[model samples]
Target: MSAPTEVPHKGLITASLMLATIMQVLDTTIANVALPAMRADLGASSDTINWVLTSYIVAAAIATPLTGWFSERYGRKEVFIASIIGFVAASMLCGIAWSLETMVLFRLAQGVFGAAIVPLSQTFLLDINPREKHGQAMAIWGAGIMVGPIIGPTLGGYLTDTINWRWVFYINVPLGAVALLGCAAYLPHMARRIRRFDFIGFAALAIGVGALQLMLDRGGEVDWFNAAEIWIELGIALSGFWVFVIWILGTEHPFLEPGMFKDRNFVTGLVFIFVIGIILLSSLALLPPMLSGIFQYPIITTGVVMAPRGMGTMITMIAAGKLLRVVDARKLVVTGLLLTAWSLYIMTGFGPQMDSTLIVVSGFVQGLGLGLVFVPLSTVAFATLDPQYRGDATALFSLVRNIGSSIGISIVTLLLTRNTQINHTELVANISLLDPEFAARMSGQLGGLMQSLTLTRGEGAFWSVINQSVNAQAAMISYVDDFKAMMWVTLCAIPLALFLRKPTARPAD
Candidate 1:
């Protein structure tokens, strides 16, 4: 007798997938704001507590490539269901962890499970949704990816402040339970030809992603190449990544197919997703620190300001879904890119005492642009894909976007650091003048400060005044320089959107 076919209920399956995707993405940043509380409770130092985050990241990164294979062998329903169950169990363990080590381990387990949620869910949605409506299906799914992190930190911040950090993980319990049950009841499991697991590819991918994440997160603190651990991890990451990239291409039975890359529309969609990931992740990484360090907004306030970005995303995605039927896919994507560019351009003008309304507007605009891009790009990738390859394509799309974001975060962090130094150097040079007019101006301010402080008029007073002025100027210029650099990067990404294979209009009935 033939095995029972898994025929997923469309509404139930889609909801389950969406819920799980949101949970996975939210967990990535939801724990971020609660790190302080977690540090104290786990009796761990700041450095040690970082593992809670890193472990999850490494697990997800390593598990990403296996999605295609897992879905192929086990049936998409089984793979997805098992993954969410594992994730829920892990989240529970995380909440109950008595030590930092245990929490880190749990987080790692969560990552392993969480990694499958997005790609598998996408595959499930495609399986259930009608071909003609695939674009709209992607529209809803794409919003989770784009808006998850935006809402995560805010949710985390509120939960941690009002309740305990453990509630954050515990909250996922009920949600995951519902998702798992929903999947079991409604997910349509298609028959799959099982293949032996690619242990070699898996190991290489795991090591590469783990080492690379470590390097990105800790490189700055350890002074980059100067530290032994940093260098060792860097070596492992590069060699592993290079080997995997080469092996995947050279081998016939590699985890991902080389032909997947051959699809012009898919590849083009990937390009947009990759760049969007970079822009979004890098901006998220950079923005909060600036707010706290320069603007001194509390954690909750920071979350409040970031809320507009998510709101914009939700609003734009809903609108984009309706508009999809009217507009060609290519035009939708281009419009998204242009809007994102404009949003970044506005951010370049931020300064001390900038209006609060303007900052929120800028964030909202950024979200709107991202919403438009993410949905269209996601749908574009699958427009011509066969059902057999949907799992592989979805996984490939996710992995590439993540790689882009990682590279983006690393590059932007390095850029900001580099630009800060340059600005600092130039600012100092301008202040150290020997000109008569400059000296006179300096002397006037110097005397006023000295008189107020009741300091003696001499070399000491002049030096003190100059030093204070230079420090203030350097700080102001550093922020200005960083914004300008980000603006240029986003603007430069604009023309590259043209390179993507434009989506075509469907024929009339």
Candidate 2:
């Protein structure tokens, strides 16, 4: 059957696409908390269990660039339907996985299929809706995108705790089934064109992305750059990326069209999305461990505290949707960067002794700021670009965002660990028996408390406790430093906001 020129059953199609989008995005983080349980049951070591996450990330990163080409080769509906089926089947296989190897393989398959869902969903939403409603549509779509990551850990923890770790994978079955049916019923067909596949370009891009993802994922584990594997991966990543760029520059039908980059707004949008991605997922990566490990909060409690952040995002995203029509998009982005930076600045002041209110409030504010930035950014980014380029552009947009997040998380986590060690050494160096500060502190409340516990100053137990306390304090200070660093990063984006041009209103919308 030929594709309809106009969107049919728009509501059903929108809901279906949203479900598919949420299902795919949710998998990115939902399996993290469940990893330990999977490891224990499968008799896998710590090193091997991580492959479950790495496999998916690398596979998805490698496959995502292919989405635009695939959509052009096959119809959108066909690719989306096949993707849903493949993803659902893969999810089932993951749930039934009896070994670590099987689990990793299934996860890879899931990643490959799941990668298309996001770009396709974005393209579909934009295609079906009128130009004027694009902002509202994107706000809805962005909500699913943003909320999925926010709630992933909480949902995964609940599923793993209440039932079993397998349920996290299994939960996708019903949801995917509904989405599949909806797509089959409501999604329209698109005209397919036969374009010559750029194997060389694709290969180079895939190798680069795959190697980069591996380097990032394994860097923290293997001590980065020190390990031969990391160096090799880094070399491969750099070489492959440049090779692809060079090939695209010279080739007539390169994988990525040069025309897309010609648009100043799209180019600026790329930089903005990259920064947003870093801010979005990196903060998320830091918070859970800080809450659970440092603050001694339970998983559920951590989730509860983080929930308000998502609520703030949802509220502002809806508002930003309406604001886009009236306000200069550049202003919204500036306001967002400042708000996000302010939130991170507040987080830098956090101490282990503080209550959860600070976290909740700051998180909500940051979310509001991010929500404000994301909607307008998406709206203006695509406003001047040709509609034919939407699929490829969205794929690249998602790719850049994902890469930024991966890099951001890796850098922050490494810094946190390294800074903690540095801080630990500095703090420990001062606590010598000859130091007067140590002596006076030992004579104060800390000393009095230790004395009441019947622990003598020079005893092994007393020294051990002192060392432990120093280490804990050092780690807290390191976390604060990381937050401060992120704040600066957010603030740095403010000036770039000036580069973004306001989107001119269209009569068609």
Candidate 3:
């Protein structure tokens, strides 16, 4: 293994890298809130407007694996710079897009360019920093990766409500420009290596990832496996993944180097990161709707309520960075997972009539837990791996994390929808005019009002009110169940921390 690269303007390079990373990561969720506005402006149907998001996701998934090959064949600095330019340019195009078709095209271009920014950024940070500083470096990187999604919707909602939805895309222009210039000026140039591009492997992986993303993203909208489209996508995804694995194992020069998996730390890190992705994004996915739909909080208020989670993550990440020097990384991971699970457990107590205090407290604790886990887990994952494979390793790491998030969000959403109906059915089963007890309670509570308004038990108005209450209660219960489910998921990941080996220390430079 080669010595880590020594760069003088490490801070500037890191700033540039983070700007690019935050820019890319923010796009993943930032556009979500803007979808309705985009649909109205672009004259798109409810079903078709989703293509705007789907295009970007599918494009990014297909293009992410190419990061390693691109960085190695072309210089890392060169590819990084180009990606920034392309991403920024695409963002501008997306902002100015005249039609849904144009918007989707621009977003596809944006995803293609932005796909390399994250893994490359991680690779660069790991390269420039010394072994001892890796904890701090990863903390910074993880903050952007984790926090961007947390804040994206909030920022997007503000932009849409205050100005226009286009600003969500336009906001990237300045950030991307700063990142582009900084990277071009301060980022070190890595030596380019000539490697044969594995077209077969690339195609197979692309097909698999793209299909899987489509299935996950589209599943909720189409009601999951009830729709034939999901089944077909699932089959294609499985077949593609199967072929990719088999081909890579047999091929002399695989798209992704198989040797990377042999590193115990790296493999464990992948699993850990996958679980983290699920926990991080799935909770984020569940919160906004719960706050806005059930609590009647406005978009801005929802963002504000959720802000503490990000704050806690940021604070803990800084602390965790320093803690890594004196603490076992594996132990920190266990502690973090426990904290997250505890937070989720708190969330299970949420009710339709409760205040935001519990939400804030639980989010903050989860943030702290996630921060503690992310920095050390990232540092340890790469500690024993060869620097030469960092590009591919980081790309694979990002890909797995994303897939995990998609899966988590989809599963939780599906459950939430199904459970709400089930709960509603069970609740309604007990409420019938035929039952004397139920009739007496209703008459006791509303008999006077019913007489004044000339309303009766059989009236549509009275039943509508009852149905609404039942629906709200059912939805609230479903949300709590989702939280409880997530808590269990977090607990399941706790034992996996034991599998992680502590990284050996290196002498200071």
lDDT of each: 0.78, 0.89, 0.91
The TM-score values for the models, in the order shown, are 0.87, 0.95, 0.96
Clash tally for model 3:
0
Model 3 TM-score, all chains together: 0.96
Q: Indicate the residue-level lDDT of 101 in model 2.
A: 87
Q: Model 3 RMSD to the real structure?
A: 2.1
Worst 10 residues of 1 by lDDT: 1-10
| C-alpha lDDT (0 to 100) for residue 148 of candidate 3 | 97
Give every collision pair in model 3.
none
lDDT of model 2, residue 222: 95
RMSD per model, one decimal: 4.1, 2.3, 2.1
Tens digits of lDDT, candidate 2, 347-453: 98898788998999999999998888888888778887777777789999989989999999999999999999999999989987589987888888767777655
Number of backbone-clashing residue pairs for each candidate, in the order shown: 4, 0, 0
lDDT per residue, candidate 3, 342-382, as tens digits? Answer: 99999999998999999999999999998999999999999
Cα lDDT over the full model 2: 0.89
Ranking by lDDT: 3, 2, 1
